[model samples]
Target: MSTNLFSGARKALVASIATAVLLGGVTLVTTPYAAASTTVAAVSVSAKINAFTNIDWLNGVWRTGAGFSIPATAANQAAFKAGASVRLADGQVRTISRQQIVGANMSIFLDGAKLDGNKVGAPQVVTIGSSVVTAPVTSPTTVTAHSTSINAFTNTDWLNGVWRKSPGFSIPANDANKAAFKVGASVKLADGQVRKVTQVQVVGANMSVYLDGAAVNGSVVGAPNKLSTAGTTTATPAPAPTSPTTSVIATSNLNNFTNNDWLNGMFRASAGFSIQASSANVAAFKAGALVRLADGQTRKVLRQQVVGSNMSVFLEGAAINGTSLGYPKTVSVVSTSASTPSSPALTTPPATVTPAPAPSAPDTTNGKPLLVGVNLSGAGFGPSVVPGTHGTNYTYPAESYYKKYADLGMPLVRLPFLWERIQPKLGTPLNTVELARLKQSLDFAQKHNVKVILDLHNYYRYFGKLIGSNEVPISSFAAVWKQIVQEVVNHPAVEGYGLMNEPHSTNGLWPQAALAAAQAIRTVDSKRWIYVAGDRWSSAFHWPHYNTQLISNPWMRDPKNNLVYEAHMYIDKDFSGNYFDKNEQFDPMIGVNRVKPFVDWLKQNKLRGYIGEHGIPDFSPSALVATDNLMSYLRQNCIPSTYWAAGPWWGEYALSLDVTSGKHRPQLPVLQKHAKTAHSCTSIGPL
Candidate 1:
């Protein structure tokens, strides 16, 4: 066997990913990811033959000029040793079986018979399952035998068949944990670290990998049974998890999530929160009378507003990047040392024989606080563009539209993506065949339920006018959200980065391409949640009251809540202006009394405000009484809206109550009259 097909082969793989910044001053200096460029470690030379690409080393042993003694189980034996040389490693394959004759006084001559010691130089490693003697044959010689067969594994190693299956049982790729074994099941890995796959590469979305065993690249089988159509491994995706993480605990308290009451999840806080002002930590738990964030991860509590005793926690759905200057203002829980009277290794618990384990508060009926539901006007159902034409068919499947809003209890789904079909091939990267069909629609919006604000319709002048670009530059639109959050914000129901659509400075570029794409998405994602798009989206002449002194700069305070401020009320088109030149005294009751100057600038900037994108224009005139008098003046001015066209407009310009053809289409018996789908966090916040 002789092989050397080097049409160029170099490889070095090391993935450690660690990004926990909230640093502020201390001489900052980030931007470092370009490492992987190595490749030169395939060295296994044997005294002298270096000339390949389909190999060339015959006369050395293929017959003549010097020494040789080949026979290690010799059936198809090959060993050339004129000047004795052999090299193979990069994609290895070369079978010689035996031979050695090196320097000044060499000695070896196989078929010509002459078997003894020192011969030439000294190296060894033939190949009948890696035999020996290529250089180190300095003694007797008579190894006439050959046998080969390899494979072993209980935990792993011996076989390099890289296996992956991820679904709800999402270990290898997507499932994470439901619907057992899949694709011809029996896929057991993680044991002893196996290594013999040789080839298996299926990537992105519908996924199907499997190299030598054959499949090879592309086949999540047209994916999308759900995980919101296989996209949310928890959005903002990019090779996420940079790793400062030791004990990021909080998953299972999305603003007050209450489920079939069994009990054990914490955080119901109200009075300025306090775990004693936390440096927050609670390890990967798993004992469960109530120990969650140890795994199902997704427990957080702070869209900012907890001051005093401070409070911070993580894990329950990762990405706690910079809760305003990286959390933990002041905490110190060190007091645990008092049980030393040991005795009872085998028999002891009978104080009446009780103790079934008790201590749970069913989150006091989820006092409400974490809700991440982003579906921005492509509302309820709208990715259908056969209208004018440039191809559009993601076929509504945000994991079955968030398991029908998690079976109507509704928790979250703010997911939108259209950076011109996710970078249509311009600067080269992130097209992975439409990111594997948008990861089967973000794994069907993270397997039925809710939590995923990944919105970024990125209107870089409409992707510079469908990839023609007249001026698409805001740092190439922050490198299309730093390359789709560097390839999708590492899952947990993705709750971050909603910065671009409806942003405006208009033909002039506001706040410098919106503060340079919000400081380049907080300089490569600094702690999640960053939805800032007023200008024309939340318009009262671009709502943001001249950035009210950039909220005492802490990058506009509210970082911990991770910043959110958008306002849009097109109250029947930019808050009704002329009732025929103020004739009817501008009635709709003075256009609902001019929304108190943008609700007093969202309580003077403690802002987490949202009317995030609106619409109500399906031929206006009391369009469902102006959409029930504009959601009863935004629930009596506490303000929270998200309606805009689902097409033939029932988004009433505020958009889709679910009626594409008439009689107010369908899903909105106007939110079943006086809207408020199940329980309440007082109207979605913290996620």
Candidate 2:
């Protein structure tokens, strides 16, 4: 027989024997022919193929039988169309013929014969273990196949542009190799060629992958040399874990404060952060942050809150401005565990400052009757003349002198005292003898129910030098008054303190000295009125020309408002009592007209005025008319006036009202008439 016929006959016999084995156990007759057939069947069984329909079972070694068939599916057809090698059960490996899919079945063309699917039970998948097998790729193949062998590759279609792991590297797109690819695993990049995705930002139309490790433009996988997802690729780094946040408390400074929004109860500033007048800042302050004020004092921030974009830090217990904070200042933020130290006390400004509070307004009678009084200088002007020698001491009259005046129905007396007599030397104790004389007069006045205006009878000087001149400091004058007040301030008969007897030659120092003395007197005695004389001999005619700053400025204000401006007026044209020699030239209305400005100024400034000293020479028609007109004007204005003098030494002097011998001067009746209305004076007839 030919080799072909024998091969065909053997294949047919193997098929028949397989069918018989499937039905039941085969009974073999012990003969030479039967043994030969059995041996052939056994040989064929050892070389038969193990077929599989499922792809997963095709992993290990498999063999091809004598009549192998291929599946008609595209995945199978494409895989076998490229001729594949497979191991037989007998350990013999052979190359399978290329196959193709025809409709729902397969067409196999071997060596020189064509095989169709009709002879096979179903299309078989021929796979082998330990070795990769591939077939000739048919032209116009509709699908691509993946390997089923241990060394097989992954389908590029299955990759679909994914990242896959390679040896120490990553392929970032579709790749044919499947050595180390996984679903969700991390892998390393190429050795010494590391890369990091610093940022993944979207560009105009696509995402830009920025890498810090290497200079590569990361684009989609379709580009040349670009990595694809199908291949083994390194994995991206996991995102870093988030860190937790911490909170802290802080404070703000006043210098940085921009504005306070009162409506919102917020304080805004240039500082980066704002503090609230409500919770946090307030709580922190109560918790103890010391705020230093502009006055160099520290206060706790008692309340604070944040409203809108502003902060409200309250220095006082409540949230307010000015009184509590006073002025904005430095703030020290203290920690919770620390204790705050006390702040220094705020100091008050001196009273001489210009912006000080105005003194209280003087007593207001609201258009009451005018008061008449007398000026007496015997106790203050001098000592009894020492033959031909000048003496610094003054010989004041005995207490009976004042008693006599009080007995004459004098309600008030302007009693003068020399500053030199009271304080002979700067900073020395007041003269005891002079003070005793003053006390004696005060006692007499008090016994007789008369008010005494204690006068400092100096011509704006202590010893022929101006009070505030270089030779005699104004401070010394103030010291003297301060001492004098200590002695006489408590006396009930002391109606007021006359700041000066007649301050001429002051040269602008009168205002400063007067104010100083008034302030000094005020320190010890607040209720008693103070008579502040004007500059230039307290002249009524010169009142307008005097520096009115002393009365106008608040700094010179007597805190008690018990100040009466004292002005002196003489009826003569020169405002000098020495004009008694020219008494014939006196005009009754001239004195009244000249004093109008002084009265108008007092009214304009809402002040009180006292004519400390004013007089006409005698009861002549001109003198009486002048004196009456002056007194009538003073009465109409409700101003108080005191006649020039009744000193024991002024005997026969012009303008003197000396009654030592019980004889009445001609001007006495005019005085009694005007004064009788204000006090309890006797009604004396014309002299």
Candidate 3:
């Protein structure tokens, strides 16, 4: 909900070079434009974060539980240091942290993690986030022929996983009736069955084909069979198209593209993506619209098409360059005169052309902004199965607990990982069991299309001493962070790391040491958002000095820098709670009277912060009053907050509400009411 925040110095770049543009063969570059203009807000919006102007990634402070993006540019450092929202993209005009947005010169969000785009060898390694190669700008279309081709076959529709172009789509298919395949162009098959043709049996002069050594239907390549891909048997009847035509998964959004000197595809060298088209696809594209993004040249729009919830755009076909078949084409999309277009994917993009234009500089969505997220441990629930099916650790009701949270439409989730169970021993490292469980959980997050924060929960020690031991040595802490970085950092649903659960410390050294540990992570993992406890009792107002380094550290540089200083909002006990004492009771004025101070202080220092911990007690629905008050306060101030937990606890505590109890407790209604609002909390809904 709360993403990039930038305020301050304006970035002025002369993207135009004062030289004659290069024109190869029929391709010609367009004149550059160096102008600025404001237009009506478009229905399509994008946010982009970058590393420029020597920016600071995490500088904004927490207002209630929300974080503001601040500027940290050198020229605007003073103003950014003073705390002011300069300007962020997507009409985002909010004050951010000094380290994040230097007076509006930068922004921060948990989008990418552990980026590695360098080429090591055959597999061009690109870690962190999902990589998209933009080429052959697709012109949206109404033609379902391509879709119908695959839809026409279910079990026979090739493999049941993602299909990628092998060594480019240029490889000609043995089937003369079908068009040539493109390089690297892949499709995901939902259900594909393997067939085996071994024992040949004659049934009254009739023959059937066997799949996986079992005959399902009488089928085989009719007529004189081709030599390459073998299979000869009785021809089977064509299957009726059960689903809609066309089998292509609509992946029109191109963010970062690279390949080709052709103006056919899309690729964004600077930020986001750029699109162009293949030469052959371009000629075909002329039937629709043809244009290229100045940044990337990966696509060309071929036809206008409609897709998604309620969006319409030109549909474009992607065929890698130099990938085509000389065989007579059966697919009507291609022209006969065409030498058979080659596959669209090149070895590496055609050449590093200009990148795609940065998505309207990363900024938060407009209107009164409030982020909602769920904690799986308290307010939500998954399956409460008996025994652990996969992982070696004992299974509880937690998995079933998540079902309720997902139903409640919780947008953000903080799923806890019991360290004692994950790493029962001290020196022994993570194994395949833990890996599989983590993968399954992450897969759940992705399937549900929600954000999840990996929560490490436990009281364990590494290197012979507990985590918060003397000075909290950096080396020991790094070990903990390294595991997370390697294991789950790249998962799309995973936003970033939550260092410790209900984190605390009496000595001041722990916070600084943790800060250092985070900084070390920054050295390798650049684009992840990190949540660390504030200080002492995990309160934002606790250690002013320790919190200062997060703002004043040397490593706090880069538009991708994402660090969040977290604090607990529990007015009572941690997991189990009675209810807030009269002192911290429900107050309609909490946002203004209490939470405002925290916001104002964050504004003053320009630091990003969050309320990472808190929840209601068991059997005490009255706690809803305080929860609503706190939630209301956050909404009023644009603070993003996550509820205490998701999974239901049978324990008799006020803060530990079970989502699946189905009794509709008092707080359930309160939470339900808020769920209707876009800015309401999402950490405590149905699984």
* Top-lDDT structure, candidate number: 2
Q: Which ten residues in a row have the lowest lDDT in candidate 1?
A: 1-10
User: Each candidate: RMSD to true structure?
Assistant: 27.7, 55.4, 25.5
Report the CA-based lDDT of candidate 2 relative to the real structure. 0.48
User: By TM-score, highest first, what's the ranking?
Assistant: 2, 3, 1
How close is every model to the real structure, measured as TM-score? 0.23, 0.44, 0.41
- For residues 1-687, what per-residue lDDT tens digits would candidate 1 score against the true structure? 000111001000111111111111111112222322222222232222111111111322222333332211111111232222333222233333233311111123333332222222122222223232222112222221111111110111111221222211111222221122122223322221111222111111112222124331112321111111111011111232444333322321222222232111122221011121212222212212122222222222222222222222322222222232122221111211332222232133322211222422112112232321224333222222311122333333435445654554344445556665666544557667656655565566566534555666543245334212345656676667777776666654555566665543354354455455666666666666666655443454335454443344456554454566655444433242111111111122222334445556766655665555443332232333334444445544444444432322221222343332233232243433333322323332322
Give the candidates in order of lDDT, highest first.
2, 3, 1
Instruction: Tell me the spans in candidate 3 whose CA falls farther than 4 Å from its real position.
Output: 1-370, 378-400, 424-428, 458-464, 468-472, 541-559, 572-585, 590-594, 617-623, 659-661, 679-687
For candidate 3, lDDT tens digit of each residue in 266-285?
21121112211212222333
Weakest lDDT window of 10 consecutive positions for candidate 3: 3-12
lDDT of 1: 0.34
- For model 2, the stretches where C-alpha displacement exceeds 4 angstroms are 1-370, 383-393, 557-559, 659-662, 678-687
